[model samples]
Target: MKIGIGSTNLAKIEAVQRVFSENDEIISVRVPSGVSDQPFSDEETIEGAIQRAKKALETTNADLGIGLEGGVTETPYGLMLCNWGALYSKTDHSPIIAGGARILLPDEISERLRTGEELGPIMDDYCMRENIRHHEGAIGIFTNGLITRGEMFSHVVRMLKGQFIYRMNG
Candidate 1:
């Protein structure tokens, strides 16, 4: 099968690639730009995914098109990030995965986040940390590399992948 992903995020692309690569039955995987980066409600997220997937399908004419949305939410314990993936195809079927990770933020930083600034940029601004993408994220700065955006996101992606399989088979 040929899969077209509606995202160019390296981590997300890699995670989806890993799944298809292992399957071997999948012939190809492609990542293309999708909807803009902005806050989206759960329903809007799914709708956006569907729209992106449909557009990708029309543009690439691939066997399958995947749209993924990455976002953060507030939980009782802390903040959680999730990657939601919607799979669309004219041939086989459709699937959706709402999986992610969680991390607690410092009250101060959480205030900043509430105002719409991300933890990464805030860390960069205050800590004078340059290009923290490879080194650390907002949470990683105070935790001394305890967790990273990439690490947490990778776990979320893996969880999404597992859900994909279950959806496809079940």
Candidate 2:
């Protein structure tokens, strides 16, 4: 079946591809609707994702349409808030919603990020000891030996995939 994904991020694409690989019947996955390169607020992210799926379905006429959106949120509580949502539409245009983990950002980094600075660039500028994923690695200079983008994205994708399946069957 042809599936249309709604983001240009290669990591998202790779995650979808990995999930689909397990189901050989899925013939293709393409991103037909992409969002702006800039970051979107939490509500905008979900709305944009839904809009993209709708647009992709209308344009591609695929068997399924998928939308993934990432957002950074702040809470009054001590925990950091970073969550992403997923939308899946069937051929009939019915949509299902899913989401990934709320990866916490350090208070200091989150404060800077809230000021509209891009995460990676901000990290690089500040010369943090952690990577973007707030992990350790080659990107560790900024992350302070925390997590890599790949690792974070992998976890997000896994959560999303599980949620997708749950929504599919639920």
Across 1-48, the per-residue lDDT of candidate 2 in tens digits comes to 676666555555555666666553332234433544324455655665
All candidates: TM-score: 0.62, 0.63
Cα distance off (Å), candidate 1, residue 108 = 3.1
- Cα lDDT listed for each candidate: 0.56, 0.53
Worst 10 residues of 2 by lDDT: 133-142
Please tell me which predicted candidate would have the highest lDDT against the true structure.
Answer: 1
Runs in model 2 deviating more than 4 A are 22-41, 78-81, 123-170
Q: Mind giving the per-residue lDDT tens digits that candidate 1 earns over 1-170?
A: 66666655455455556556654333223443344343333454556556656655556667666665554557676654434556666655555445444456567766776787755566678787675634555445656778654555456446555666676688
